[model samples]
Target: PPDDWREACLSNDLPEAGTLAVTLDEQVFCLYRVEGATYATADRCSHGRGSLSEGILEAHTIECPFHQGCFDIRTGAPTALPCNRPVKTYATREADGVVWLNTSPRDVAGQP
Candidate 1:
């Protein structure tokens, strides 16, 4: 569960054309502040086990640094071929000047 969950950034902490990786609750979350609100997903690419934190973000998608795989930031669904596996994603919400991620108390692979 999210205990006393607090702020992640001041919205501008991450650029609109890039991403930011932050460790929260022992898990790595890759935050994409694209366009307006922020989006978050597990920092690992499910397909080749690539570190998504090291990938290049394209709009609402992330290109895996290891295998050039692409996944949607909003749903963590693989958008490119050779990487159909979906990564764990978290719910995002913005309050004040900060962004918050909700890592539900469920397995990432079995997330609803």
Candidate 2:
């Protein structure tokens, strides 16, 4: 395992093609599983500060429930109106039936 990778949840804990909210080191993260791949991003929407985990997940995008803003789950890029700022994204992977998250957040340029 990578030094920065910390266990977030068990693989079975996430529903297929769904989203889950997880807290690590007092920071909230939104976890998503789509097409057998997992992704992680800051749980809060940059624009409305809404919980992204409580929003709707569609393909590689998540729509903020509060203001209907959308963001690309992979890069945290805002994809719709009312959300011009990118949310933070974390590196994630699944191994040994567990989902691991890198505590360090990706840069605003979307580099991990």
Candidate 3:
């Protein structure tokens, strides 16, 4: 693993089209597996205190459990009502059966 990346979980632990909630350095994050890629975002819903990892995952969107507000898992964009603010998105990658996350927020182009 690279120095800037932190292992979040074993790749097998998060199957395809699944969500995983993880905490590192006292911060919570939600990891998702869509298609064959992995993505990470703030676990808390921007519109409420609901845990996004517990929400439903539809295509590339994650619906908040509290208000049913939806957010794009890839870009963290608000896609539904009651969620006007965007959640912070982190960089993620999977290798050697381990899921790694770059806690630092990445740019829209996916560059850190």
Ranking by lDDT: 2, 3, 1
lDDT of 1 by residue, 1-112 (tens): 5563546667778777778888877878888877776878888788867888789987888899888989988777789977887887777788877888776522445353
Worst 10-residue lDDT window for candidate 2 reads 1-10
Tens digits of per-residue lDDT for model 2, 1-112: 2687889999999878789999998999999999999999999999976999999999999999999999999999999989999999998889999999998998877777
Clashes (backbone N, CA, C under 3 Å), per candidate, total: 0, 0, 0
- The TM-score ranking, best first, is 2, 3, 1
- Write down the RMSD of candidate 1 (Cα, Å): 2.9
TM-score of each: 0.82, 0.93, 0.92
Best by lDDT: 2
Kindly indicate the candidate among 1 and 2 with the higher TM-score: 2
The root-mean-square deviation over C-alpha atoms between each candidate and the true structure, in angstroms, is 2.9, 1.5, 1.8
Off by over 4 Å in 3: 108-110
Model 1 clash pairs are none
Q: Which candidate is the best by TM-score?
A: 2
lDDT computed for candidate 1: 0.77
**Which tens-of-lDDT digit does each residue in 1-112 have in candidate 3?**
2565788999998988899999986789999999889999999999979999999998899999999999999888899999998898999888899999988877765455
